[model samples]
Target: MIKKRVLCFSAILSIMVLSKLQSRPQGISIENPYKQIMLEHAARLKEEAKSPRNNSKAYFSSLTFAEASVPTEDVKVKSKLSQYLAKFSFKKVRSHEMHNRADKYLPKIAKILKSYGIPEDFKYIPIVESGLDPRVSSHKGAGGYWQFMPTTARLYGLKVNGNVDERKDFIKSTHAAARYLKSLYEEFGDWTLVAAAYNVGGGSLKSSIRNQKKDDYYKLRLNGETASYVYKIISVKEVIENPRMYGYKI
Candidate 1:
């Protein structure tokens, strides 16, 4: 009697599980939330892939900033960029807000950057730095539109004292940022490396280059953030410049 009861309970449990499985949608499971999210994302992407405006070639080609190009052709770089592209693959309400704020300044910033002899694309630095937010301050003592550290601000001829912080002054700080980025470009002779220096500090990048005997930004054994710094900027540039290509409505 005990054996019969146990067998019957096992049979009933198996039947319920089989029924649940049969009732579940084809090739979809409720077990893993992460997988479910990815599947949903893939479905969205499949829909977007049908759009004729989706241009992967043009998007990949724009990865080159100044004379230096991201090695998006490399398997690792391609994979990494795909990861960022996925992360950036979102509706652009936030980006539209930033872009609306950016419009008033980007033309001026572009002119300033051009006059300063830096690539106009470099103007995106401040976008990545503070999203055109003149009031943003980092925990690392960086502040203002360009996100200058107090010392770096002063070094670039911006006043950052208690009485008045010129780092918060849009025009002054943009000029300072242009000067600083130019100086870094002069030091590195590569805009990509200059960008890395801008993010991770010239000293650290210099040391990495010296020790590694490899000036290539992609080759250096950098801190994780620094390693992917230029890639982040490139990713932002890709999305911002071609929102439609990335499936962003804004």
Candidate 2:
């Protein structure tokens, strides 16, 4: 749960200066505004070379200047997004309700997944899917913790009826989700892509993989939403397991 680090503008500029100083040892430290002074000094040195007799006391005096001051590179600057997210966390509010509702449903979800020998991370599917709200429905009619559409939910053993839509049932939907995730993982052999497929369907995901010529999730070129989706899930998992790492109290 390491916080993401970003270097400051000045720090990056200093690095560029240090890189340019590699060929000239006796001149500018280049880490200071004295860079202009050093440039003038180098120009005078060249002038002295052009006319040897012009290399007088004035030229020698300028070359004997002290080293440029080194500004502290250790200064830590906070990221604006990190600061903003810390001041206001929607996850904190959403997660409170989830934790309460999860107590009544997570046990059932875990039991089904465990009985099928699914990975424990599968428990997070509900959080990413519907925030564990049974009545949740996507614009595409994907419903429940499984977020299965009308056809796919039934294909995976969830019953949808006028009186009782099993997609809204925690136990049945978790099982269906587990089976679907497992099947996608088997097909792609990568959990990250499997999660992406869960969002955008397996057919399009496979097409992306073929078009990119990369089986690895990190290497594939995906749309912005799909690209960040896996990392978002991982970020949520990291935050939940150890909230303090991301400046969360819970």
Candidate 3:
């Protein structure tokens, strides 16, 4: 009788367990909230994948700025990009010397940028800054391929003096630029903001962000030059990478 009682209790317990399991949904756990969230996310992604907008070429052709991909859907960015593309087109441009210089120096600059873990897209900065001319100097006294001012050059370990200015050295200046860019990225946490700070100075850009309560480089109200700086870089990248697309023989 005792054995029979024990067996009957065991059978009842098994039925209860089986009933609970059968009532619950398949392939889902009630205890794991993270798994449920992931399952929902996967379902959402599957639906998005079916959307035609996600499959468009324009969506895929987004340009990368310092490893951050930006869609080309913004009207301001598109307008600025179009202007530069037309300007850099073979028929509109006077000389291909810029392209030639880029071919010569980009390999070394790219290697230095890579060594510092910077994006290769930053190699185009020298092209826009000084037209890849090592001897070029701005009216404000910034010089070299990377265009470091005297004070900034000194700050980055480049010796900038009357007789021996290391800012004119492409190799050294490129390294200095990389260091400066890396520091800016660390502070701002955004490559686009880094480029803006590089143009307008960190203090000024920070002030703008604080006052306007806007951190986005594209949306921020910056000076004319700072506003167009990143777009110019993107345009340069597009033309350089797709020379044939822009009708350039080089």
Candidate 4:
């Protein structure tokens, strides 16, 4: 009878162990909870790898002159980028309108720039120049999306008369800007310098280059606006391309 009882107790213990095993989750070992935590952590990392916020380098690398023109490693460029990133506000920028206009216009601008062998990055100029607003004008005589002064507008095959300002015509002005940028690239042989020349004028940039004996845009001591111009463009590019990273819904 004692032997019978011992056998019954053994059978009951086996059933209890089997029931406990079945009640626990599948594929997860209670003996090693850390392995499940590690698996979860690895999955989270994989998901983060696919997110843009964690892939800023990939975005930067995809751009033309990714390293040469907008060197984020440079102190001045980094500081200016921080300033602009801080300054960028989706509410103030009218994110929906700006993004909608960008979606409408940036492809055309990129096409023109591409036709001229200009870096597609130059398409960001209008974003920095006029907030992509074709009707916007500067305190100076600069007007339109490209922000061309009247004389520069006329020089670049844009009509600047009272009746019609071709600078406000997105397509025509983009073409003109493309041509102007091409000419500037010929002069500077550097897209970064071309951007600087576009901002401060070829003559002023040339003089600065000659006087400072520095051909590098990052090294040149320029007026505040001109100095920050390229950095602002880079910043705009970053904010636009990584809007969610900058707290911009659009």
Candidate 5:
């Protein structure tokens, strides 16, 4: 009689447990906890976007100028950047043209610079040098993307003879430019100075820095082109990187 009572009680307990489980909501689940988080994110996406909270600061946040000299705040630098922003870069035709040309050459130049442990941002040097045009020639005989003179080209292991000027060869010229930039980096230990030295030669930049005794690119009394060289680079960097900010379509 006692055993029979115990059996009956066990059966009653199992039925009660089943009934409690069945009473719970039908579709709720704990299988994937991330489901709740993802649903919250989906709701957020449905909300409207807001404009930049601080437009001026936010616009410049895209530009770091990392591993290069001339901060965005410097007067001369800003002046040059402003010049491009106001005129050529913001004008859709011009901005589109330079960027379209840049697309072909910057990748190879950036890769070569990286291989030599140089800053990849130095790729913009070509945009400053020749607007990424391999066939361009300056009044002073500087040629190719990096605008190396024949002597400098030869020195950097590029053949610059009548039959073959390797400076015109994008692949070889990028390598030569990397080598030349590495040497400049060694001389000045500053990428901005390296770029300046590239434009006016290392000896000239060294002399200017010594004469000025300022050891600052902004203060060094350079020729108009060289004085404006780094600022131009920074300017191009700003506009090219932030085309939309300058009102460029692409």
Candidate 6:
């Protein structure tokens, strides 16, 4: 009777070990079937969650621009600019003709901006403003990449006459732009605001600054065009330095 009882106990223990081994994978040695099953279930659930959801209601339907959420302060303007940069690609104007033109103009602009302690990035202002085409004149009488109106040009010491519009002279106009930029920086103490004020006048920018109670360009309420102006300059700077990164082949 004692031998039979011992035999039964040994057989039951062997069955329990076999059952545990069967519940595990071929290469694994999991002792708990419940834990192994739970881990497999979790993995499958993760894959399901990663699968694309086709329901349109799950995401935003309307088109939204980055600036929509930005506050009306100069700093916010810079921050929003960093966000806006991801959406658009840049184009490199590397045509032989354009490069030739840029060669003639970029040096002088760089020299003047350097003299003023402005960033080397300022050299591209003409690329956006005038495409290095001195003969190019805006309908509003703003000319050159530094794009100065007759009144502003004169204020910056660039002569605008019928025979000789100094606005078309790269060297003279850039000098004027440097002087004007320096003055704007002096008044606002911020490069972002100075860049914006270049598009609009300093007086208008200062009024906006005071009314907004913050120096942040992004946080301040501004006209749509002017709001984008400073960011456009930053975008231009980024693209010019590494056009390929912005997806411009040139």
Evaluate model 1: give its lDDT. Answer: 0.80
- The alpha-carbon lDDT assigned to residue 58 of candidate 3 equals 62
* Cα lDDT tens digits for candidate 3, 42-79: 99899767643355456335667877876567776666
Q: Per-prediction count of colliding residue pairs? A: 0, 0, 0, 0, 0, 16
Ranking by TM-score: 1, 3, 5, 4, 6, 2
Cα error of candidate 5 at position 246, Å: 1.5
Give per-residue CA lDDT, model 4, range 86-174, as digits (tens).
56645455655666777888888888889989888899899888988878888888999999999999998998887999999988999
Residue pairs with backbone atoms closer than 3 Å in model 5 (clashes):
none
> Candidate 5, residues 223-242: lDDT per residue as tens digits?
98898877677767767766
The Cα local distance difference test for each model comes to 0.80, 0.63, 0.82, 0.80, 0.75, 0.67
Candidate 2 vs candidate 3: the TM-score winner is 3
Report each candidate's C-alpha RMSD, comma-separated, in the order given: 9.3, 24.5, 18.5, 7.0, 14.3, 12.3
Question: Candidate 4 at 14: error in angstroms?
Answer: 46
lDDT of 2 by residue, 1-250 (tens): 2332345666788888998876555543544557777889999788656642234333222221012111112121112223332333335676556555656766777788788766665676677678877788988788876778989888889888787799988777887888888898799876667778887889988999888888766556777667655545543444454444344444
- TM-score for each predicted model, relative to the true structure: 0.75, 0.59, 0.74, 0.72, 0.73, 0.61
Give lDDT tens digits, candidate 6, residues 128-175.
677678777888878865789999999989888887788877778888
Model 5 collision count: 0
> Candidate 4, which segments miss by more than 4 Å at Cα?
1-69, 89-93
> Which candidate number maximizes TM-score?
1
Better by lDDT, candidate 4 or 3: 3
